[model samples]
Target: MSFEVDIGYASARGPREDNEDFAAVVRPAPHDEARGLIAAVADGVSSGGQGRLAAQTTVMSLVQDFHGVPETWDTTVALDRLISAQNAWLAGHNRRRSGEGTAMCTLTALVLRGHSYTLAHVGDTRAWLLRGGECIQLSQDHSFDHPDLRHALSRAIGLDDHVRVDYSQGELHRGDVFVLTTDGVHGVLRRRELAARAREGSAQAASEALVEAALKAGSRDNATALVIRVAGLAAGRLEDLLLRGRQLPVPPKLRVGDLLDGYVITAMLADNGVHRLYQARSVATQALVAIKALHEARASDPQERAMLAHEAWLGSRVARDGQAGLVRVHELEDPSAFYVVYDWHSGQTLEQLIEDGRRLDVSEVVDAGRAVLKPLGRLHRQGVIHRDIKPANLHRGDDGQWRLLDLGVAVSGREPEAARSLHAGTPSYINPEQWQPDDPVRADAGSDLYALGVTLYQALTGRLPYGEIEPYQLARFRRDPRAPSQVRPDVPIWLDHVLLKAVARDPKLRFETAEEFALALERGASRPLPAHGSTPLVARDPAVLWKIALVVSLLFNALLIVWLLFLPR
Candidate 1:
């Protein structure tokens, strides 16, 4: 169950193409003898935002970080780190160019170890396995249902507010060939054609052949392909794999007994960027608690330092406000060069709950809303706007309650200091007014209501209210989205109305405050639930329809056969 690999990449700008559609290769780091590999293909989103930059950054970062990937790394963590880093970089880059921001791009990255491989992807760029004279697709295309699909990518790096990557792991066998390519290749060359190319020659040759085929087939975009041939098995070198390359700046090592401020460091949560969340004891009462240390490097950076400070202050504000639905920030203390102290409840993030495949029943969504809206209402009353309100920030406690986290981007009206700072938040959940250049009233209550609407949409339909769109495309569809009931029929009508109003694109149309929104939702939930209607006319008796359709098909075929076999003869 182990093997070395042969890697090669081939790319071509097709007839109707201008920008290169394909970028793929394996970076060989001399320092890391771990034999790590990074194979990626990015299809630049053609509309705007330096798509090439998005592709190049994604590929370059993955290659640089591939050598140090953890053996026991969770795909979720890897994806989060990759996309989050890219986003911060993109955000900074975008600030320089008012309208020339980097364009989003589809991404597929693979890390290989002996015979095992890990894959992560967004959009339509894909990975495939060619074995036993057959080519099997290993990735699904994130595209809308359409005849041609075109350049519409469901997910792309640096495009949307957040990148949600689909990740998977698999075993590699000797003689098995893996192909990674942008849409130009698979969208043009058929699977049979790819399989034929895989059987023709070495990995390098096969890669070239596939790209050529895509060009011959009139692929109208940049075509890129990678061929990886499994050579043979070798020893598992997990540690060597991650530590061999260019030195990664390591944070100071922490120990269990080390005390900073009033909190005690327990253990390291992760390797990079100092994810040392500690179990600290209260100095006043000797009660155990949890705290997180920000990376010293990040703390030293001016922008990051400001964010850390803001996070600490916001945490304390929420706690002092006595909001039941937010993590209580007891006090701001420099546990280390960078850290925040908060009263921690043992609970899972909303993301963790979703990952656990736990569906939020209607009552659960309501109860969770009650928890979230109350704290939000409190913050609003204090003239605080939590710009980054989303599921990842929602923590579900053991007491069957939910809470908010990381209000670093929060805006407090009373603070002349905060009022001067510019807009900040995850774009997917942000209100339009928050993103505006000019300062509007920014009803803290109104913004919170909008986020609650989005949360409800996600809770019921398992999808975003406005669907996925690139950053540049945001302006095109700024209006309120179709109601939730249209997207998910089973959603209660009253709840749907409540959510729609909360997320209404027009502030004038949305609820006046979080409390008001909560009241409306509560009323919606209080009404008697309706039963699902009877089966539609088309579905009432499928058997009758099937029989009628079958008879028609049979008669048509019989007539065609008679024409060919008897009448024509």
Candidate 2:
């Protein structure tokens, strides 16, 4: 499958002394086709002193910055962040040149990713979709209501410190046409007239015709038109993704001195039943790295292969912008086998550190929690949930940084439908609700917090809070486990309360977000601690209270029966 498009644009100064409109279409390289094509148009505020610069910079920045974002990010997320940053830069520039006047502009952008189109708009510039011989407006004009002030924009880039961009998305099909225009063009031409011109000629000719029509219709402002016609679309099927994974054969029982691609295997790190990990060195750079590949026994399984590919995809998206601890995945150059290569780091697994009797001070624990939660927070913001977060999956580098790892069971907002019975995460660390049959509440950021709480508890005291739970056994969370302070005397009372709240059995009782959990941990020393045994037994351990009630009732009934029998004639 392939995604091919035809793009055309035309700009006119019209009756204005200077043209303040800009537009562009960005085409990705062969390797970046998955990121898709982008079309953007910006119209500068005519009254502003730097109108032309504003329009040019807005369009050019979007085209360049959008592609720089991580491929794993959803189209909406990537666009939102890029636009917000651009707005900040424009606003700051205007402030720096106080007397020079503001740099303000209206923007509309369209992204064709996979099988859908994402539209982002601000101010009066408009976006439209022409299909089935009908033209439909896809953007809302941010202008005032009063007739005298109708031309005044209520929202535009560089107008404020922060801008609210309108966003929408819909599925795409072949032959769909996307149109963008500044107010100068759209305000002058009627919808029907614009549609007629768009359907009359090629995309380039149609764009030029639209601009000419606006100018002839007495448009006093600069006019610009951009047209995009979808020539073809790739299937974007699961098989297409699997084919990429299958480009190279699975490595067969790698050993020391073995060579794959340009990397030479130096030592085997781990060989779990499902996958193998090796420490290798690059032949060209002589840099040490880690290579992970699926086990030969599971290589043929579609599910396992899909998970491995997804792990690589998810990792690539979140490792940018000073996000430390996560090792970036390197793209292979014509590899002969299927595997993932990661930048090697000299680090020790959290599990190994705990087993080696390395004690962490409260300050260190707080810092670690903050480090891990930062990336988790980023994932949640992107509509992703890390289902598996445990000691073995966290690495603490010698540089005093902690990074979360292993997104094998991660769930994204765009995840495909799967069976509800599929197991997720390790049983021992999984939230109690996750173990319930047909559980309605799916694993989320809160669930990740529960697992993190367990890890923290284990690190402080070399024991599981509720004991290890077997996979098939019923997970009973009705008993209140010993608090962290009780298990480890050095643990502060306030810190223990924070951990208890994090691991609460009911989802509602736990922290609602990673940020809240991290804040609680950071401020543990300053906050007031709850009184010992403050939680009601019924709330903490309902099952135990119910048993005691039953035993008491039975004893009272027996005594009453005996008293009546002895007194009766």
For lDDT, the strongest prediction is: 2
Query: lDDT at 474 for candidate 2?
Result: 47
Any runs in candidate 2 off by more than 4 Å, and if so which?
1-241, 414-421, 437-440, 472-476, 528-534, 540-568
Task: Please give the distance, in angstroms, between residue 497's alpha carbon in candidate 2 and its true position after superposition.
Answer: 2.2
TM-score for each of the candidates: 0.44, 0.58
**For model 2, what is the error of residue 54's alpha carbon versus the real structure, in angstroms, after optimal superposition?**
40
How good is model 2 by TM-score?
0.58
Global lDDT scores for all candidate models: 0.67, 0.81
Report per-prediction Cα RMSD to one decimal: 28.1, 15.4
Summarize candidate 1's per-residue lDDT along 200-280 as a digit string, tens digits. Answer: 677788889898888889888788888888776443332212211111232355577876666566654443563456676
